[model samples]
Target: MIDRPRRLRATPAMRRLVSETRVHPAELVLPVFVREGATEPVPISSMPGVVQHSLDSLRAALVAAAEAGIGGVMLFGVPEHKDAIGSGATDPSSILNVATRVAAEEVGGALVVQTDLCLDEFTDHGHCGVLDPLGRVDNDATLDRYREMAVVQAASGSQLLGLSGMMDGQVAAVREALDDAGFTDTPILGYAAKYASAFYGPFREAVQSSLVGDRRTYQLDPANRREGAREIDLDVAEGADIVMVKPAMSYLDVLADAAASSPVPVWAYQVSGEYAMIEAAAAHGWIDRRRAVLESVLGIRRAGADAVLTYWATELAEWLR
Candidate 1:
């Protein structure tokens, strides 16, 4: 009615100038999985292009990611054995800790090295924490594990620790532990608005997770937007340096809310299911892979995420350049 649309859409240059949010190579973080006993990088069938890297291959990947100018890499470990306590998570010799050290050395300040501070990959039962006598997740016991994990991750040279277990008081516990251990400079990226979603299917396969049940008891329900904000507020008060929303595509509303109010950076995880869907659709010629990828990233940026954790972080950075 105002004849404004035509003026703004006049040309490509005009469109570029008017774009509200733009994606850069530095705004992406890659999620990498390293396994304890792999001879080579093992491919995950559920996630078409992702793999669990062996140590040698992981070093190469870190070099490439740093060369590509990615913001960081998030490390997850797949141990050969699991126990009730997920002892490997806090063990200095664990594959994840080893990988974190390797990444930090390989990148050498060229990129941020982040580690996942959750026990899902180490626990035999595949839950995020130790279980009670009745088999329910014991929140208090998990806090102890998290505290230990923070120290290990910081010692491993991780610039940031990702608290993805969705446990109460996790941020405060980890913060105190890190301070007490004299690793006060390491920051925590709290997964504040994580929700129980089907989008983590491929991720479970990537990590070889043995989860017996859903995470709804700890993860938030998608229907509650207000709860997402509350979680962010609590994490910020507990000394979280950054907050994240998981399964970003379906949870843009929550992401936007966190971005609007967060005093620190707001991040989003483009989980495996989201990546698989786009890759599957593109393989079948249902969508243009380049355009679709750019549009998806743009949508997340428009929702106000400062950075995105995506499987395509390296690839996208290359394409953009």
Candidate 2:
């Protein structure tokens, strides 16, 4: 008798029943941007379905995300003003902090309220850290700012602080700050293996970045797989509650390593460039959009991401339900 492996591939029901991996609504996270003074939602040209939401609009988005049953929303702020030190990042009144307050009030019980704790969005030069007079990023100084930012974000009701700056000692610094400030319950999500990749092009536009140069000095080199594993180990040792591998699809090997070794939850970010590529290709009718999106995320899950942060979170969650 011939072996019939095709039996499992015979029907949708058979495939579903024997699937080794599954993507669920509760494992999705939506990354949201809220502008400081806009009266309405501002569409991002590069990322077709995403928008920079105003305060009032952000509330509705949070509610919608909660209704969709996604795991949470990660908030990024676009401030009205930018400066060298990114003072807005530490200000209690900054758009990010304010949005955190609003999100906590709106869906605090329904979803995890997370915030981006990087300086790039608020910095005039758009580097993830403060620059010294020599025009180079100063790592130790950046940690000081991160410490301050962590306490403020926690105070503003951020349940999870995403440290995406790639600065040395950031996780330890922020964790210490949160503990010192009586926010021991708050958690930190380290962007452990964030690569300095071309994949972030659309994200620059979405946040209205003023970046003058590449982040190669801090972000990991995309070509190095072992280094990615090392960063995950470092962040975990430094006290991260969760660890992330960014620009998910292209870095599945690194993500798989992280998921296998890390003690904490492992997450992956389906970055702006990944989202744009799919959306743009679908627009040209090159591929079936729904199938591509589902497969892309499922591949990431199969590679071992406990959760995925994607612009398609709410829509995908709705489809899953």
The number of the candidate with the highest TM-score is 2
Q: Write the per-residue lDDT of candidate 2 for residues 1-321, one digit (tens) a residue.
A: 599899899999999899999999999999999999999999999999999999999999999999999999999999999999999999999999999999999999999999999999999999999999999999999999999999999999999999999999999999999999999999999999999999999999989999997999999999999999999999999999999999898899999999999899999999999999999999999999999999999999999999999999999999999
Give residue 60's error in model 1 in angstroms.
1.3
Please state the error at residue 160 of candidate 2 in Å. Answer: 0.3
lDDT of 2: 0.96
Candidate 1, pairs of clashing residues = none
- TM-score of every model versus the real structure: 0.98, 0.99
Best by lDDT: 2
Off by over 4 Å in 2: none
Those runs of model 1 whose alpha carbons end farther than 4 Å from true positions after fitting are: none
